[model samples]
Target: MRELKYLNKYLFKYKWHFLLGTIFVIISNIFQIIPAMLVRDAINYVVDNLNIYQSLGQSATQQKFFTVVAFGIMVFAGLIVLMAFLRGVFLYFVRQTLIVMSRLIEYDLKNEIFEHYQSLPLSFYRRNNTGDLMNRISEDVSRVRMYLGPAIMYGLTLITLFMMLIPFMFHKSATLSWYALSPMPFLALSIFYVNNIVERRSEKIQEHQSRLSTFVQEAFSGIRVLKSFNREAQSMEKFDRELDDYKKQSLKLTKIQSMFYPVIMALIGVSTILTVYAGSMEVINGNLKLGVIAEFIMYVNILTWPVTSLGWTSSLVQRAEASQKRINEFLKTKTNIVSEKDLVREINGKVEFKNVTFIYPDSGIKALKDISFTIAPGESLAIIGTTGSGKSTVSSLVSRLYDTRGGEVLIDDLPIADYNLTSLRKQIGYVPQDVFLFSDTVANNIAFGTVDSDQSKIEQAAKDADVYHNIMEFAAGFETRVGERGITLSGGQKQRVSIARAIVREPKILILDDALSAVDTKTENNILNSMKRIMRGRTTIIISHRVSSAKLANKIIVLVDGSIVEQGTHESLIGREGVYKDLYEKQVLQEAEEKTS
Candidate 1:
């Protein structure tokens, strides 16, 4: 019942259509049950009261009996057909409305979840699985469709039929009605027990379903890697184990269901027998007529269907509740990054780190400690360091992917947190170490962030990134679909496409986090020259491990152990004979040895 609260608003919003359909059901069932009652009256009239048949001047007693029975049969058949037609008519309209409601709810829920994803911190995404996130938005939203359709109407039908059957049963014999109600308490208890089991089993199924989705997604994504390393068979064995676990869990749930269903049927069968025996005694003792006994039997059969619906509905409600629990858990979690209200900032690429300190969540010590720096407009700077020297962390702060712990990262002389997130991101283009491409055209991939951009702009960006000629050589040219994550493209091509996407944004602050590492020397030089030409009046921060790449910057900052150790032009850094110079000599000697060989 608590799970229903989330759906109440939508139910009320579409109440008129539901009420109309319900009215049709009520009318149809009323006409449908009348013939059953009339059968007993007609039979009793011919057997016990022949005066009415004689006064009508039909025929002798035997002929009148056949005539009356034939009339009753015709009436019953017509009413049954009419009821069936009404059921079909209402079902069509009701299902149509439900389909619309389900689609609307699905769309709104997906948008809300996507908005939440956009607001969450990078730390959240780093910690969570991508496949789980996908399941939350796609599969979970779809689960609500059944709730709006069969589950809801079946519950309503069960409740209404239960209320109506009591009067019909008591009309035939009060003692029979009381006896039928006797088995209800046990039925309710068993339903409650099975429902509890269903909840646990359903939760297990959902958990394994998410794991299966994640494994399949990750394995398919890295199929090329596994094949190249000759680990395809090993990967398949792991997948087979997961599939077997899923199958075992599914069978356990099915076994529980199979047991619960028979228990319900057995309890129902007991009541049916008792009802039949009690009604038959009433007829034999002359307290009830034979025709009335027939009506009682019909009512008992009708009661049986509602009982089955109750048990079946209980199981469905339990499964839906389990799914609701997972969905609600996702909805209740708050994002670490919150947007400022109605905030926007015009950017000119003056970036400052003011007494900043930051620590990753669930980690000890700060990633950046008491760090402060300032970069003027149009200046190009390079950050160089060994792995985990706070170089990437500092770049992430500049892009406002995360907030600082102690102080602030200011852009355009304003605190970054004060600016609208979208506006701020629009002005700062960032390409991380791992490039992501959608399954779309090469032109669409390049012009992703720009709304309503034409093909010329995409072509220009591709040319700037030195990838235009390669795209032209493809069979479909610019319209060639980049396979999932651009799997069909080479690593260098993927990196170039990612760079082209950022360059097309025309950002005021451009960040390249080892984005050119996949390309050769000639291609990297061409892209560097393109940036130099177009980056006027904008700040550019390049992070790289290669000394050749850092040499293009006007000034270089070398980080060691989360602190800046050297900051100067390449010529000045080499003259100092420090860590930067030592790294430079090492690379130069390696290149010289390769050339001599």
Candidate 2:
């Protein structure tokens, strides 16, 4: 019951519905008890008539006796039918109000969790898998619904029945009721034990399910690699291993549940036998009437279903408690980055990194260390670096994808943290090395960053990215669907589409991290030439390994091992005997050698 406390907010939201549904539940239970009482009354009437018939002997006509018995039975049956009908009506509304409320709450919870997931920083996604989060939001949420809806409703029914039946039973025959209910305390203890085991097993089952979902998602996403490597059998074997674990856990839970039924029924069986034996002895000793004994038996029968349901309801409660705890743990996670109060909402694209340092959340090694640089508004700077030289890290910081640990990332001379997160991100356009495109139309993919981008704007961005001609070649042009992650398109096509997406936003800062690496030098040169107008009055940062690309920038910086080693114009760097000079000479020689070959 304490586990249900988390649902207080939702319950309060739908308080009126619950109140009406509770009234229905109470009325239905009350009506249900009437039929049993009617049965006792019917039996008593038959007994009284029998005694009168015995007294009348020869004077009582056969038809008259038959008429009296039929009349009494008919009256009782009519009352029973009327009560049952009333109960059904109330039960219908109980389901309508309570069950529907649960669904509404489920809808709210699912949307809330998804919104929170979106609000979380990128580091959170890096540490968690999609499948595990999916399982929590789907399966775990459904489990909580069971507790909120059916469990609460049925638990209330059982409690109401107990309150009504017990006192009546004691009034009829306290001795018999005492003897019959002696097994209840033991039954309760058993239920307690069962619930504990159920809670533990339910958690394990959910965990296994999460692991299985993750495995399948990863395998399917990487199916191309598995096929190329000819590792189908290996993948199948791993999947089978996880499947076997899931099967074993499921069976263990079933085995525990199976043991519950017999233990419960057997105790109930013992109580029934004792009540009958004691009542018969009392009748023989003239301490109780036969009709009273029959009524008590009917009451015991009514108790059977609710008592049996105790095991099931407890199981629902235990599982829900476990799932709620898991949901709470996820909701408690604090985002690593948070925007400050009263922050600026506009950006001028004057970017500066003042002695910044950053390390990944999990990794102890620093990604960028004591780095410092500034790019004025409307200026383009190219960063050339070897693998892991912190080139991409600089682009990430400009967009505030990550926050600096040691120093400040400033936009328009204010710390980046002093701007609203939404405003800052809206001002910068970032294109990463690996581009992700949804399974949507080409036009939609290009216009993804903006809400109201029209056809002309999409085409203009596409033309600037040097992809408009290629798109026109497609069967349906911009309307054609790109497959998952733009898999149907070539690497160069995907990169161009991604560039178009960023350009359509008309952002103040554009950061391209190896974005043009997939295209040929001719296409790269053409795209850069076309981007001149778009890049005007906006800061642009190009991170690339190619000297051909870097030579066109207003300024160029060479990085090695997380620090800048050289900074100058291409001609000035070529004049020096340093890293930039070596890189330039190698690329020029490689091109000439390739042409000769």
Candidate 3:
């Protein structure tokens, strides 16, 4: 219930809609009750007039009386029809305002959650699964919307009907009204008891739904791997097992929810019986008119639908509470990686790491240990290391993807945190080892980072990355669509296209983290030659294990177990008997052996 209070701000945002909807509820109910009163008066008028006409015994006066009675009945019927029509119109307005406002809030809430997801650091994604994150924004929000739209609408209708109808019932006959409403307290108790169980079952159902969604999403994403392993039958078995569990939970909820309407109808039956019995006794005693009994029955019937809806509206509210609690859990999380300063400054790409040490938050492994380095503006530095030697970590720190645990990372002589986060990232073009591409055309993928990139600029970047010829050979040329994660292209082609994406950005700092690993030596050399032109005045850091790529850098550093072992020019490092020289010699032998074979 407390979690539901978060929606109050959204409600306030669309206050006028709610206010108008409330007015409509009141007016519609008024019109609804007026028809019942007219029915009561019409019944009494017919009873009174019948006796007079019979006493006149078919005279001219009796015939005149019959004419007047028919006219009166027609007028009453016309008025009743008009009231019903107006009530329906106001009800339509109620739906337009309240339900439409809920949709608007749903739109705003989803956008807000997605924007927050984008602002969160990379480590947050590592901590949470993609399925759960998606569930919160989609399925969970839909449940909350039920609370916003249908539950609120029905709840308001019930209140308005009760306030208007109950008092009139009492005014007609206190004793009879008491008998008619005697079952209400019992109904209230039943609802209270069922609400708790409904809430618990709803939470379980939501959890299972998220699990099912995650399983399906992962299974589809890795369909190629599943088929290669011939695990389709196994996957189907797992899905069936989960589906059975979900079915059982849903059935339990439905069994309980099914109890609502029967109980409401039974109670309403009891009210009807009591009202008839008491009202008939009053009429027999000449204390009340017989027409009043019909009026009481109509009132009870009018209240019937709203009373029965109590269980449904309560269930909606309980489910919404459960879903909103899940949503708030993520919305409350504050990202640690945020810019301390708002000032935007141009980056000159003088990146420096002073006594920097970093540990991965998700897996508390220290990736960098008191490492120190500096790459002056317009210089090229290549970091060479074996797997898990903190080579990629260096590139991430340069991009400020993660903050250091015990030291400072500076850009242009200012702490990285001082610059605006967006501004800093915009000036750096990074091509990661594991490349990902959206389902879009090849030209669009290359021009992804540059907002104003034309077709010529995209083609130029593709040629510079040595992927132009391959793209031109495609059936659609640069217009060819790369499937999910660029599955339409080969490994080397994907790597080159990613390089083209970075090249098009024309950033001040370019970090290539093993971006050319998938290409052969010939293609690698061609890309390196093209990069030499692009890297002329940019601060570049090339992270790779191959000596052919490392030799192009102005300076080379060898990283071993998160510590710098050697730092010098490529020629100087090769002359030394250290980690760098050993790596270079091994690569040289491997290449020679390949040629001989």
Output the number of the lDDT-best candidate: 3
Can you rank all candidates by TM-score, best first? 3, 2, 1
TM-score of each: 0.88, 0.90, 0.93
Model 2 lDDT per residue over 400-511, tens place? 7788878898889988887888888888888889899999999999989789899999999999999999999999999999998998899999999999999999999999
**Model 1 ranges with Cα > 4 A deviation:** 1-4, 15-32, 38-69, 97-103, 142-149, 184-219, 224-268, 594-597
Tens-place lDDT per residue, model 3, 1-597, is 899999999999999999998889889899888988889889988998999989999699989999999899999999999999999999999999889988998999999899989888899899998878988899889989989998888889999899888887888789888877787767756765776677788789978887897799899999999999999999999999999999999999999778766877787788889889999999999988878888888888787777656766887887789889998998888888788986597788898989999899999988888988899999999999999999999999888888999889999889988888888888999999999998999999999978999988999999999999999999999999999889899999999999999989889999999999999988999999999999999999999988789877889888888888899998898787988888888988998998899
TM-score of 1: 0.88
Top model by TM-score, which number?
A: 3
Whole-model lDDT for model 2 versus the true structure? 0.85
Is 1 or 2 the stronger prediction by lDDT?
2
* lDDT of candidate 1 at residue 443, scale 0 to 100: 91
What lDDT would each prediction earn against the true structure? Answer: 0.76, 0.85, 0.89
